[model samples]
Target: MALKTSCPCCGKPFSAPEDYAGKKVNCPKCDHRFVLKTREQALQEAADLEAEKLRQLEDRRRIELIEREERKHRDRRASMPYYEKFQTGTRPVRNYDPRSGPGFLNLRYLADLLLIGAYAVLMLALAGLGLTVYLKFAGVISSIVILSIVLIGWILVGGVLFLLLKYLAELALLMASLGDQQNDVVRLLLDLRDNTDVDSPEQG
Candidate 1:
């Protein structure tokens, strides 16, 4: 006797022997091949497959939402006025070009490092010279007093120099990052210009 079953590939009803279980067969509509299974096993497999499909759809929807938010941010940046964009540090407003040299050879950053290093060397040299001169010319108590004053002045100078260097270094880093982003934007624009069809503006 022939048993009735639906072809998994084409969804067409057909009759086959019960002994056909676990045997490969081809569907008539789509010509897809699959192994035969009991009705209960097929039902369970279908349920699991549908659940997986729904999970993948939900993941794709979440990714689309994230991409939309990023696009909005880029559009907002592109729409800002020149002055406002410059003030916000989003514009490429640097006086020096960063792409011409190695990381340490960038002139602006090098200048800041030199200023900090000069201050440090000067402070150390002055402290050492003053302490030695005082100890030689005066008593230990007098030398100690003079050295204390020198140390305090050194600290004040160091603190001021540090603050200035820190500000300049931060500005340099911000300019470098902004310049890189601007370069990327320009490259993307160039690619669009080259690839887009001029005859059909609406397609772009």
Candidate 2:
């Protein structure tokens, strides 16, 4: 049919006649640059765009149909008793408890490894200090004093690091435990409400 084009910058519409094909021109309204297309090429492009829109509409319709089916299935399952819900095996029970947090991947493991590494490093430091002091002083009374000082420093630093790490690890575990307990209480409350609602209908 006829050629139709819009300004690339201002999006103003314009018609391209047969003489304007393959010509470069500025839009009259916005003075923006755009190339005019041949009538046949413009028609083909329009067809392609219309085909793309139809395909998208079909895809959306298919998705909506699938979602509607799923909703219907969920309603059917809601009508079924709890024990019979999984009897068909079509829908498996997926009880993923988030409060348990990532299974084996957690901070406690890293904390334990850090504690072990810190212990080994401190022990090595103590050994190195004793060796250096013994070599430099060579069994003098000053050597005993230096070794005592080194031992005391080692004890103080090591104790602080160890206790800090111990507290941190225990605190992490305690926090996780408290979170799980809170979730358990919420879940129990929900179950209690559900049971009361379900039983009230029967009792009435």
Candidate 3:
């Protein structure tokens, strides 16, 4: 599209391009020269162009700030070992050195190792008991009845011991996890806060 204009002196009509708004032009009929746009229009367009430049600069700064913040959050999450557990579907094993940690924690770790060793010995004894039952009842009772007695005894004893061990460990870990969740919520709130004050470009 072009700017519609007419020669003021001869009243002859002609059209100039939008880009030629502020430029001087000659009339085709009488060779009269004039500017396509008025002085007020040219100054207003210049002011508008300056305002557009400021707006674009403000927009680019806002985008860069947002991108930088996103990168920081992403890097922080990636560096956390606890966050990786879900993706890996397993926790990384760390050696529990008694000398490296608190005294009570070290004692608890040692106790856990001793309990595991005792459980292993108990399982072996249970196996021996099953063997003894088979030997004692091999000829005296039916095979199904002997097997039933052995299974019921093992189930009752093993289930109680397993429940005691598992419940304590799970409860302790659950309390620790709850504490971690509380800290995470506070950290997240701090991260999500908008501390940077950015004023938008003023158009005049």
Candidate 4:
């Protein structure tokens, strides 16, 4: 009679002679050598293997659920706006660098120009006042009214001329710098226009 046998390693079925039962046999499929077990022992081993497979499947299912939840959290974060996704503490701080890139003249220079121009205008005004006083004491001007008018006019004209010259110099410098970086200036102008449009409300 033929004995029914199955490989323990690969579970491949094969037929052997009755004398082969309970003897060491090498599995044809897996090449694993083992003593053949009786029907009862084989059934029990298969049951144990099925239980281990179920446990492994449950562990794999648990891992997959955790990974799916993590993926969902990542997707939610990715959907958020840039500002909302990151904390303020993690944001990089930037300091204003005066010499960062090529652009218009420094504002400090314009301030210096204003200060120097104002000082010069004040000195000229003081000189004019002194001259008017000297003329009054010397009897060159007959009326105090005429002296006052002359002094006032001198200071006003001198201050205006200084301011005009300063503005013209600043404008010339600005134009030259803008001409040199024409592309960058154009981009800056476009950005300014866009910002202005965004800020302004549309009229019905």
Candidate 5:
């Protein structure tokens, strides 16, 4: 009597000898080569093999994902700024508040104003006191002395006051720039903290 078998390649029913174990057969539908087995046994073996292959593929995919995440973490850590490592203290180095108060009333500004007033007074005094001495000399000499004294006094007072004002102006500008930089740093740090908190589960 002919025993029932299935072609592994085609899933087609066929009649074959029961003793034909591990015997190669041809699929009539697709002309593929496969071993002959009972229909139920062939189907069960095919399903089991497919399941094993699927499990291996899933495991490989999971491993790849984990490796990718680790690489990203390593790259992010490596790309951090150089200063972040040496910064041991948690407190910020500088703080800025633009709207807190007026900057014009500071000690440096007051000093500059005082220096300007003093320079003006000295210029007036030099012009008044030296006029009589300058008038006593002869034509060219008196003229030269008067001109020289006036020029010298002007230079002394104007130059000194100009330098002082320039220095104070520079100082004020530097303070403003530093304040802006400090404010920017503080904002960036706050943003970084907010992002970190959102991504991490643990809170401080």
Candidate 6:
């Protein structure tokens, strides 16, 4: 017996042997080979293709959402001021540039310089006090008293010197970075007085 069927590839109606109902065949009109699927198998394949298309669409949506979030983060970062991004002690000191325009003075740098100057004055005062103590008590006081005074004076001087050295180290870093830091106290104070008017954006 012959079976009536249509070629899916060429859309040509043709007759096939009944035994060819669920087999592969070639379309004579288009010379295209295809599987002659049963009605149930064809339905299952169409359902599977639709499911795959849905999965692909969902994946694309998720990727688009991720890209949108990334763009928002970039915009937020771009909107922030240059100064807000820098943290103290995180930046490495750079070489001083003489030609670079005098930058604004940093309040923190001025405070460090003040502390160093105070320590220097304290050292001078301590020296004078030690000299007075030695001259006044050298002849009448016991040897132990003289030794104790010397020891105390040396300890105080050592402490002040240690602090002074630390301040000097900090000052060196400030000077090295003065291309960004201010050139002098006057320029620094002037900038401080007019900070709001200064355009301090990061320029390329």
Q: Considering every candidate listed, which one attains the maximal lDDT? A: 4
lDDT of 1 at 160: 69
TM-score of each: 0.36, 0.41, 0.34, 0.33, 0.31, 0.36
Show where candidate 1 strays beyond 4 Å: 1-147, 200-204
**Which residue pairs in candidate 1 have backbone atoms (N, alpha carbon, C) closer than 3 angstroms, thus clashing?**
none
| Residue 184 of model 1, lDDT score | 53
Q: What ranking emerges by lDDT with the best candidate at the front?
A: 4, 2, 1, 3, 6, 5
lDDT of 4 by residue, 101-200 (tens): 7554564456457667766876787788789889989999989799889988987888787777667656756765665468554544444444342456
Q: Write the per-residue lDDT of candidate 6 for residues 12-107, one digit (tens) a residue.
A: 977767667688878879877876766566578779989999999999999999999999988886764432222112222223222455443564
| Candidate lDDT (C-alpha), each | 0.65, 0.67, 0.64, 0.69, 0.62, 0.64
Model 6 misplaced stretches (Cα beyond 4 Å): 1-19, 83-204
Give candidate 1's error at residue 52 in angstroms: 14
Q: What does candidate 3's lDDT look like per residue over 1-204, in tens digits?
A: 677778878989788778777788989999999988854685787699899999999999999999999999898876765424223223342222112323345435555655675576568658857775776676644576766787677767776676666556555555555655565555444433422245889999
Tens-digit lDDT track of model 2 for 26-131? 8979887767888777788889999999999999999999999999999998877432453422222233222345333365576567667667766776776677
Tell me which of candidates 1 and 6 scores higher on TM-score: 1
Q: C-alpha displacement of 89 in model 6, angstroms? A: 11
Please write out the lDDT profile of model 5 over residues 1-204, one tens digit for every residue.
Answer: 445666666678777765664677676677787776655676788799999999999999999999999999888767644334224223432233223453435654655665676566666656644663455443434565666776677667766766676666666656765766676567556644543435557686
lDDT of 1 at 141: 46
Instruction: Summing lDDT over every window of 10 consecutive residues in candidate 4, give the lowest-scoring window.
Output: 88-97
Against the correct fold, how does model 1 do in TM-score?
0.36
Instruction: Pick the winner on lDDT between candidates 2 and 5.
Output: 2
